[model samples]
Target: MSKVLSKEFLQRWAPLIVLFSLCIIVSIINPNFLSVRNFARLATSSAAPLMLAIGVTFIIIMGSIDLSMEGVMAFCGASLAVVMLQFNSFVEWGFLAIPVAIVFGVAIGFVNGLIHVKLKIPSFLVSLGIGFSCIGLTMVMTGGVRVSASDKAFRLLLTERFFGFPLMVYVAFAALLLAYFIQKKTALGRNLYAIGGGEELAHASGVKVERVRIIAFALAGAFYALGAMFAVAQIGSVASNLGTGFMFVSITSVVVGGTALMGGIGGVWQTLVGVLIVAVISNGMVLVGLPTYIQEGVLGVLVILAVALATNRKAIQLVK
Candidate 1:
């Protein structure tokens, strides 16, 4: 009975409970932590990581990892600023820049999927190579200079608030909703879990594992593109390192949200809670006056704890 209860607790309530505990601690340390203003700021800050987490959620669910988002995001940010209405821009596509950037990212995703699925390359190696290549491309594009695209309209996409929250928050919310829809309502989503849980069995059952895997990476790419746009909107500029820290933060969000690194056991809602936890921790640390350097330690400990709790139920004889 104790074992059963603990398993249920870990699976059904651990992430939420951890999130609430963090909220309570932060609110106690800084009474103003619960204020609407701070929450709005938190929402804005979390927008980019949320999208990245959502994108990778499907990939992780399919028992694969893609480390190329950081590169993809940086490349897309450059593309958006260069093509959109901006200072020093080569074109003035205005709103069209967003979709164009997204498509560029999708193309990259398709390549990643193809190499991994068809060539049988490890997803990890493929994504890492792609990410490095993208970073190189970004540096070449800008010649080591940051591009500032202070387009008022683009800024408005992030600055304009409705119901006390920025439009960027709504955009992130929409992304979450769409991710949930995909997870629950689509065959692609279903195949992802099947693949993760048991790829050989899923393939034997006619799940078309390769096709599903490719599409999963493609979806992840599309989300990475959107995340790049939001990142630029939040800063009003595009830098070669605009995606500098996304890989760690997004992975941390996915892990802290109770998603297994081993895959097949989590969904978008878990990732959303994870994103909020990360945002709050990042913001709350400042409010409570924790030293900047110690924060990484805190996050690392939390991630370890989350992973330990999640994978504790079963033991593996071998790990690659």
Candidate 2:
């Protein structure tokens, strides 16, 4: 009985153990990696990706993927930048811009959901097409140019720190908490799990599968928009290419957090830990003087390994 219990414990907690060990190893290699300033910087730098990962976690929970993340983020950033720069002339609007950006995000997500549900198309293709369309739209709006950060208040929201933590970190924590609530306390959350487990079964069980999926996609879009806003705030500018490569990075974080790719499992808290692991590896690589170009390759390998360890292959069967 003790041996059986030990095995279960290791299976459940192995990822966290590995992540903590890596942190310790990296810090030992470079003491600066453990400094307070670096810890703060890491939290700030990871905020956007963490938001993105949490958003994607919902979509994955429904056995679907949202590749429109990069496009959604780019659109949000571009729109926000244009509003605060070209339209408002850097005037402070007292947080009104944030809600407006969030609304735009939901609208984009709704459209994406409509396309998927109405056309009966696979999410992958629908999201890819929508993402491309958003990119084209952004290009047309910005004329392929960068938008400078002009809003003092918006900039402060990104740069300011409270109690030694960046404002963005607080925002991220709030978002994470909201996600946790939705996944745990809401009926919609339970429906998501059911759909992920078996869509037809969920529909037969009166889960309102379509509505839940649409809402999930919409919520993900909102999160992506928030992430984009944070990105622009952090960098003080917006470019057409601002969200490039985010799709894979966000998905990687989710998978690393022990969320099953086959779906019907995992939660936002797992995503939080996964985001930290990815952030630590990336930050540590830089601190250890690894070449920037090699980072992607390293991440790719780690992603495969993590998936292999976390996935329950016996529960899932494949034709191939």
Candidate 3:
């Protein structure tokens, strides 16, 4: 019994343990990697990707993928930029623009979900197409140029620190709490797990699989929009490439956190840890004098290895 318990504990916390060990090793190699200032920078830099990972976590829990994060974020960021910057004679409302971006995110996500569920299309292709379409729209709207905003209050949300922590960290903490409540206290969350376990069984068991899926995707979209807002607020500008690499990074974080790509398991807490691990690795690499290109290669290799270790190969057979 003791051995079984030990094994269970190891399985659950192995990723976190490894992550911390890596941090320690990196700090030893470069003392700057453990500085307080660097820690603050790491937290702020990770805020956007952390939110994106949380969003994708929902879709993964529903046994689906959302490759549309980049597009959704780009659209949201672009919309916020145009609205607040008065791009086309549109009136600017300081804080109100945030909700408008979120709404557009939900609408786009709903359309993506509709295409996947109603049209019986795979989410990968559907999301890819939709993401490209959003990019095109952004280019057209901004004429392939950057959009800048001058809202000082809006910028403070991303720039200001409370008790030595960026305001975005507080927002991420709130989002994490909300995700936890949804996963543990809501019927929709249970239904999502059931669907992920077995879609046909869930359908036969009276779960509104389609509705749950659609809602999950929509929520994911909203989160992506929120992340985009953070990006814009932090930088005080928006660009077409604002979300270009987010989809890959977010998915990588979720998978590294021990969330099975096959779904029906894991939660926001795991994702938070995973995001921290990834953030530390990236930050540490720079401190250790590794070139940016080499760091990317290392990240790719680490992602592949982490996924292999986290996956339960015996429980779920590879479909392809």
Candidate 4:
């Protein structure tokens, strides 16, 4: 009984515990890890991943997974750059590019959800197919070349700082707040949890499971669009590879933050902790002189450990 209780406690608090523990361990190794400057940098680095994780959190809570982030992000980033370039800057009418990018993402996500729900296809497979298609479309649009969106006004997201952190961090925080609201205060959010708990039961309870799933996916795409904007801002350019590596980072952060891949067990707040945890580990590893390969290995191990502790194995008899 004691052992079971301990496991439950750990599962409930693992993300927070892991975050604080990583902070302490890294600070001990390199005191600079605790410095305000380093923290600011970490916040900047974490902003994009946080947005991506937040977007995916909704889908995950619905017991579905989205592997379309990389392709979606890249396509959106490229689209933003191309659209902004048409007007030469983010001033006046050029600002329209932002919404255009977000709407594009929403459409893509809507279609993805529609196919998944209507065609009886698996979520992961459907998303993966759409992701690849998006990537191919992006490549065609850009002619296999990088598009530059270095407009000074738009780049302010990364260049300009207020209160010791970049504006992008604040934007990410705002996104987080909105996502939290949708997840907690809205009917859709409640329905998501209901579906995740058990889809058939949710449908039997009169919940419009299919509609909620579509909306959740569309909302996630909007967040991914925001992530793409931040990613472009951080680099001042866009390419087919603009979203490279985000898949590993965002999903890892989401899971590490304690949102179970099996779903119905986490939130955006947890995703925030997970993003910070990943940022700290990556930054700390660099500060301590660890090679890239080792950092990757450490992250993989951390994900496995987090899932092990967070998963209620007894509740899930079939591995699937």
Q: In candidate 2, residue 164 scores what lDDT?
A: 78
Candidates sorted by lDDT, best first: 4, 1, 2, 3
Q: Which regions of candidate 2 fall more than 4 Å away from where they truly are? A: 1-8, 86-91
Per-residue CA lDDT of model 1 for 1-320, tens digit only, reads 79767776767787888789999999998999999999998999899999999999899988799999999999999999888844333334577888889998899999999999999999999999999999999989878898887887788878798988989899888889999999999999899999989999999999999999998998999999999988999988887899987887888899889788888889999999999999889898899887756766777888788877777455677777
- Best model number under lDDT: 4
Model 2 per-residue lDDT at 142: 88
Query: Whole-model lDDT, candidate 4?
Result: 0.90
- Worst lDDT 10-window in candidate 3: 86-95
TM per candidate comes to 0.95, 0.94, 0.94, 0.96
* Better TM-score candidate (3, 4): 4
Clashing pairs in 4: none
Note each model's CA RMSD in angstroms.
Answer: 2.1, 1.9, 2.3, 1.6
Give the best candidate by TM-score: 4
Winner on lDDT between 1 and 3 is 1
lDDT of 4 by residue, 172-255 (tens): 999999999989999999999999889999999999999999998899899999999999999999999888788778888998
Instruction: Quote model 1's TM-score.
Output: 0.95
Badly placed stretches (over 4 Å) of model 1 are 1-4, 86-92
